[model samples]
Target: MFRGEHIGELVGNPGPARDAFPIEADTYERLDDEFYAGRIETLTASEQDLLLATAACTYPPLETADIRQRSAKSDGNINVLMGRLTEQGVLYRVQKGQYEYTAPKFHEHLIRRTGSLPR
Candidate 1:
């Protein structure tokens, strides 16, 4: 399920990557530069770790256990981190304990962005 009726809002202008299945690098760059950067700007290190953990999932829809396994920072404050991410529109609940990104390809974007970061 997409975020809205018009999918264009998320995947509209292909810019340069052109939606190449696994998602191209340029698309990630453009999306990060234009949209995700603003979204990521306000997150704490733990919250960003949560986002990366969610994106790195093998099957997705990460649960509390999954997050703990994936993130070293998934300590006592995990609930708080997840709650903050939800408040920021970075993630949404799919069920009682499962969560997914608010945007469809955002996880992929996170995965892509990870390779380019300083650490």
Candidate 2:
């Protein structure tokens, strides 16, 4: 959400420090798309898979059991990967064995990507 890659993508300019930055043409219609996609892109396959499974549920503090029921990645390291997501501020621990996303809209984004209606 806060990356300079925005200017690079939109401006298509690679000027030095002395170059003037564009004051307009600075908006993206799909800010949510850019923000969340960039965030998901930073994760490993394990992390992304876990996250997508969790997004299958409408509510949180999610459990590994929840993911187990929804995904083929039952043996994925839930603890370590969830902890890494927590460290990245993507998720927060609700208890010893449950976690939830920090960004609220991310759930909807995942749902749309996976084409899975909330259950």
Candidate 3:
């Protein structure tokens, strides 16, 4: 025969985890601005064009082929750009050969800055 144990004993106190990682309200906006600036600075002209084109679209989770058309980039180049954006957390892969902005607001930000998608 075996004895059962309380879940709390096994898991310990959950409250402590929350306490240890308390949110910092003040730094968030500053940090976000710094991060966005850094990321934009790192992109090449072609990559910036691709990102802006994708961001201008109203529909999301665009297929790789569709994005390639919109961005007017070669298939190989689009693959490379998508891989880099995915690594940077600026894009999210929704499924095989499909992706979308990591956050919709980020797309809106690009649209506001660029005023329109690239031809």
C-alpha root-mean-square deviation, each candidate: 9.5, 11.3, 10.5
For residues 2-107, write the lDDT of model 3, one tens digit per residue: 2264434536555544454445433444544765556666777877778877755655666777676677778899899888888877788898898877654565
For model 3, the local distance difference test gives 0.68
lDDT string, candidate 1, 61-117, tens digits: 768777777777736788888888899888888887788777766766777767532
**lDDT of all the models against the reference?**
0.71, 0.71, 0.68
**Backbone clashes counted, model 1:** 0
TM-score of each: 0.67, 0.65, 0.59
* Candidate 3 C-alpha RMSD relative to the actual structure: 10.5
**lDDT rank order:** 2, 1, 3
lDDT of 2 by residue, 1-119 (tens): 53676565655445453254432223322644667788888999888887877767757567766766777654556767778899988988888777777886677778767878767
Best by TM-score: 1
Better of 1 and 3 by lDDT: 1
Candidate 2 stretches with Cα past 4 Å from truth are 1-29, 74-76
Stretches of candidate 1 exceeding 4 Å from the true structure: 1-25, 116-119
How many clashes show up per model? 0, 0, 0
Q: State the TM-score for model 1.
A: 0.67
